[model samples]
Target: MTLKLLVFIHLLLLIFMAVGCNAQHSPEDFDQVNLINSAGPYLGLVVPNSFELAPLLDPSTFIPSKNVSHIDLSGRRFHVGIIADQKVIVVMTGLAMTYGQGEDDELAWESNGDYTRDIGYIHFANYSTEESCDNLLNNVWFNPDEIFPKNGIPEVREHAFWVNVSETYYNLAEQLQNVTLESCINSTTCLPTTPKIVKVERGCSASILAANAAYKNLLHEKFNCTLIDMESAAVALVSLSMGKPFIIIRALSGLAFSNLASKNAVIALTKFFELLSDKPTNGIEMYDK
Candidate 1:
């Protein structure tokens, strides 16, 4: 063969290999047993105050017909053990707080005085007085600086699993301290004399922008996957930027304080678990891939 022809063939082979490496995984390609085992931190954020996986704890309900042990990480729980001779580990983490009366008020945001209203941008204005804000900042898990220091980054355990529910929106709201007039233009009405609107965004919806921006910075710093659940786009962005696989699963619990039944929380959990078991639907896997 001519030397030029040989070089061309080599280049084609390289291209083929590169494409093969980046190819997406099909349902058939994933071993069902392997997938179940690989799934970690089936994190469920915005979980109801009464939420409980006690059913999972009951071997009769859904525990695989193998060695499956359940561990309760405070409110975060999961099943770990071998299933069908394959090791299956599932971790479930609750949201930062629950929603409802007599719940962790720190995690809950309020619009007027009642916790029923959506307290979007208001969190920024109320952060200093919010107890939940203090807990989140001081909490070892939420604060990256406390968990992973700047000087020496600790090695994350390959199997050490963690999952989050849809709590990022609230978390972001808690973090945002100030808002400029430019960002809130149409969504909010402001006076020209003031130049800036002091109105709070209620639910940390405004914080989403800032959180996603910060996530980008974190991604550049490290290659890791960050899975953000529904209402947790900000957290997901941070995880995505780090090159980490971020899986977000959001269950529609209910509209904010619309007299919705508590049963909705259970239904949301069911839907979330269904999503977890079935192949990616509604293009949910696009971000993860």
Candidate 2:
């Protein structure tokens, strides 16, 4: 071969070697098996809101003996609670928006010129309103006999039980309802009112998106975990599109599309943990079979 031709061939070989090296150094260089324990599946516990997981926030108060860890993504403060060799992460969602703020003047007007009485009354009113609404809704929508047939009643109740107990769900529902009611009331009061979006779009928050992204990134970075629970449907979509195994362990936080509270939330969480404990981690190994 001519000198020029030989030079060209050498350059092509160098290019090929460089491409091979780059490909070898790609993100997939990390092995999934090496990151997570080969003995069991890594559980991804996701609480919808911070309040739902308040009990588990302090590891010193309640420690689990199982091989599990917890992450708290409830507010601005992110905390990880590890128990029984498991990891738990805690995250904060920031200050939640509530109804109109009560001013000192308003308090004075409401209370007989007594700050203490005003505070007590306000507290009582808040609890009373919440209890009244909860009782009304629970009696109406949660009438097992009317809502579900005898055969399906047990299944429906089982699914909704957890959500019924969670405060997060109730708070969310109350907020949405408050917004809706205020809008409707304002529209009624104002003439020539403009058209407004009355329906609250469920599960559409930047915080939620950020939390899921951070979660997936952490899983990939730390445990090389590709298989994840299907709590966040949006996250599931992204994972599924990427050809990842997205297993969902939703414990039915509430009705098909309803708010959750104390009973409902706790039951869902407890059931999820129970299911995780009962299921065989190796039932369907990811990246293996």
Error of 2 at 43 (Å): 1.6
lDDT at 129, model 1: 44
Clashing pairs counted in every model: 29, 40
* lDDT, each prediction: 0.29, 0.28
TM-score of candidate 2 against the unseen true structure: 0.28
Residues 37-143 of candidate 1: C-alpha lDDT, one tens digit per residue: 35432322222222333422334333442423443323444355422222233444323322332334332334333243444323333434465445333422332
Q: Which stretches of candidate 2 lie over 4 Å from their true place?
A: 1-41, 56-231, 241-263, 283-289
Candidate 1, run of 10 with poorest lDDT: 1-10
RMSD of candidates 1 onward, in order:
20.0, 25.1
lDDT of 1 at 157: 20
lDDT of 2 by residue, 1-289 (tens): 0000000000001111123333443332223212223323333344444444564444443354243232111112323234334333333322221112235423211233222332332232343356445332232122211133233435453221111112222222332222211112233343233222122122211221222344446545654544333234433332222233322222221111112232233333343344434433333222311
Error of 2 at 219 (Å): 32
